[model samples]
Target: MKTDPKQTLYGMSVQELQEAVKAIGLPAFRGVQLGDWIYKKNVLEWTEIKNFSKADIEKLAANYDLRSLDGSEASFSKGLESTKGLFKARDGHFLESVLISQRDRQTVCLSTQMGCKMACSFCASGKAKFLRNLTAGEIVEQVAWIQRKTEKRISNIVFMGMGEPLDNFDATMKAIEILIADWGFQLGGRRVTVSTSGITPKIIEFVERVDGRVRLSVSLHSSKPDVRDELMPINRRYNIDNLIQTLTEVHSKLKREITFEYTLIENINDSEEEARGVVKISLPLNAKVNLIPYNPIREMAAVYKTPSKERIERFTKILMDAGIHVTLRKTAGREIDAACGQLRLDREAVSAAGEPRTKNHEPREPAS
Candidate 1:
């Protein structure tokens, strides 16, 4: 497929913009000016850049796109203000990002890839065939688009949406630099998180790259190696023992808090023994456990069910009794199929069936 020609200026760093401007026959300082306009001023149109002459503006416009969420496809949850943006890549495949609103904070969950190859059995994202890695610009644009749409400041960003962020290490790191740079979003390094399904080598590289400034979350659904290996195929390559050891070394060096995301699936890994296993692994590293009750996806509903309230509470108690900091994460945008890849899957279904697509804001039954 033919790709889109116009390059995006929104995600470029000051140095990168300078290089780009030099390539376009403009003075190097012009690139810094472009970076300020796009990142700080949030300018969408080339004409809005007043510093450049009309001819120069036209020339820059011809080779670059100042795109944001202004005209992109979006859907909002009916019951809540949660919105999902469907960004069409240059190759015409759609990637989804979600904006979740709660209290005063707006958190945008960004996707690093069109689809996931991790193949975690319980995640809807892994069910979709792997497409391609999203560029640094593409990943950064998701936040820019959501911020423009909601008219609210995005306080936190989580790489917990559709893909294994560590798998696309270079682009993901570049996006992080863009997010935390003073000239870019200026978000605090601690407020931004990159969650991985235990890609051991990348985890080590991530810690070294950011020097443990950016928060890290691991999707450690189960503590048992056998159970984790079955649920997350990546475990076959990097098992719990190796993952925990790496995390231990990184944490000891940086003393940054590591979060382990545990999705409690009933009859799978929700038993008291499993909770004790989590406690054992987490206590050694002083990790915070974010317990997520499994969100049922149609493909895995028959085999997986969310742990009951009692089970969830009991699990939390086990960790707390052991001095482990734990929080039960509230499932947001369930009514809108907001879980990982649900929105993208829904869009694909609609297209395959030749149905008219519309913005759906009403609360509906949860995905089967």
Candidate 2:
């Protein structure tokens, strides 16, 4: 894609980088040098890379963005518990990437699009209008930027940040390849989990692509058709029943880590009926359930509420009783941007308050 001239080199494979360099008046061998600088060295600024002359840096930067986080910005929660980086696409739209730390694990929840089209009621991402799909490079850059700032190695990658991963199919897959390849981030497929709002066809395509190496998570807020349709607008197109039926198609083929990310809303979907409904859907496929009690989005505060402790425990007990493995997700980082798309919303709020912000700045040339 970088051969297209307009495309950036941030997400290109070593081969593509080589071809891209040769196409832009540089030797093919420069691709090896460039790849090492971007992926291995994890350089986020062009000027910081060594062994390149100022003239060559200009030639390379002209065609491809050498660094991923050139003009990105970050906001961290108190105690540095969670951090979010708002990345600016070339066209000037913004997307978010969140870094979460658990005992020994550093997980980066990455986004695939500018804003979500899924429009799930409990989410903060859809509050902003959908812009466009993020390029593979942009998706990969989130990790580099987040890792650089926090100085922690990312142990796991989750696509549960903002956008639906399957909607941006090709780019998401390309980004995954760059993430898992030995020449790239070098993480295994199991370390990366792709979450979706149940795009059936694309989900099937995804599992097949990686041969079920990468984990899959579906946003199944409710098991009932009407409730699911209301929570996730995408369900109206691909109903929950049909979506699970679609999962059954590939479940046996690879038997990968299939998870149902159920966000329990107070009175909305925390009842006994809802819990039973979840077992019925997950039983046959052996899919695990990750229970995320709804994190109230400030803009939609009146719309949803987190379930009480007793209710949450009851909800989890029902699923476990049915012999389904379940994980109850604890909410982290509340004081400073607890929700997924809130950081971008925070920046928006700042801008709306008439504060001057700069996301796009002139690239500094490398010194001689």
Candidate 3:
């Protein structure tokens, strides 16, 4: 088997890191030191490994190269203080990552896959269909690239950017292990969140693997099967009831609060009745509802619209009145086409047109 040298620092367990050092003819103890530099110090170049002998450092560099993203193009949110980088992978594939600077910490949302297969009606990621699953190194490199450019430590990471995380379970979990491992990123488990679109078997697998360490966010758009099937095609395969059952099982086994991401769309699934249904579904579980007003996309305009502010308030009131914890996530980067896949699509159009293409700021219809 050809060993993957670019094994993501975000995906390796401590023992795995030790194994990597051993492969390079270094003492196992060197894994701990390397881990400290990778995670704690956040170093990339082998020369940064201060304790390693010059010959050993040169050997390590020659044998293995750390995966890092080279930002080909970038767009920043002048209004919200966030930047999205269009990174060119070594393989010439393009992936996107966002760095959002908030009051205290800067968080980078990383993509686990190049394109998405889920085909959520409101999301822009799957517009090009599923391309490929990102390697653990590619996923981690998004963070490293953004960190290097901004010179800010990423306080949190969300697997909500592109691809269904649970669909890429092994790489996803390995990335989480790297983030939390002492030899890796050394981040607290709670600071990392993995979002999935109701992949039940993987939820069970996650429960078995994580054991209440990392957080989970499930995209629960609508409680009705018909509505969900129309919005998210994945619902047709997994359905809502089975998904809820699996979430319940995972919660029971792990004893953690899972977040339910409810993207409210106008006239489709944002009624008081639906809000009531949301409460009924969530009342039984230890979960919080994150209500995101639909991020309007030009391609998806005919299919979806944001509910009136009054309607959103009414919907939120229903959840809060029902005593269910809820939050209305303010849509960030409205100035730029900040939706997950918008940046790359614009870049593609520009390249194809062979000119500077103007961005359509007006929200368009969602993909069907």
Per-residue CA lDDT of model 1 for 205-248, tens digit only, reads: 88889986789999999989899988999999998889988988
Residue ranges of candidate 3 with Cα displaced over 4 Å: 1-14, 46-49, 349-368
Pick the TM-score winner.
1
Model 2 lDDT tens row, 1-368: 35333667788998999899889788988888888777766787878888888998998888776644345665666677777677765554567788888888899999988778989877888887787788889899888887877788898999987788888999999999999988788888889999989999898888789887789888899988888878898999999878988889888766575899999999999999999999999999899999997878888888799889999999999999999999998677565566878767666555566564443321121121
What is the model-wide C-alpha lDDT for candidate 1? Answer: 0.83
TM-score leaderboard ranking: 1, 2, 3
RMSD of 2: 4.5
Candidate number with the higher lDDT (1 or 3) = 1
How many steric overlaps are in each model, in order?
Answer: 1, 0, 12
Candidate 2 has which clashing residue pairs, if any?
A: none
Q: What is the per-residue lDDT of model 3 for residues 1-368, given as tens digits with 9 covering 90 to 100?
A: 86554544434566876888799889999877776776677676666678989997876677666445544355667765787767776554577878888898788888898779999988989785677888786787677767776778888998888788888888888888787766677778888888989888888888889988888899999999999998899999999999988887667776668899999999999998999999989999958999999888888879888889999999999999889999897777656777888776666565556677555442222111
Of candidates 3 and 1, the better by TM-score: 1
Worst 10 residues of 2 by lDDT: 359-368
Model 2 TM-score on a 0 to 1 scale: 0.91
Each candidate: what lDDT?
Answer: 0.83, 0.82, 0.79
Better candidate by TM-score, 1 or 2: 1
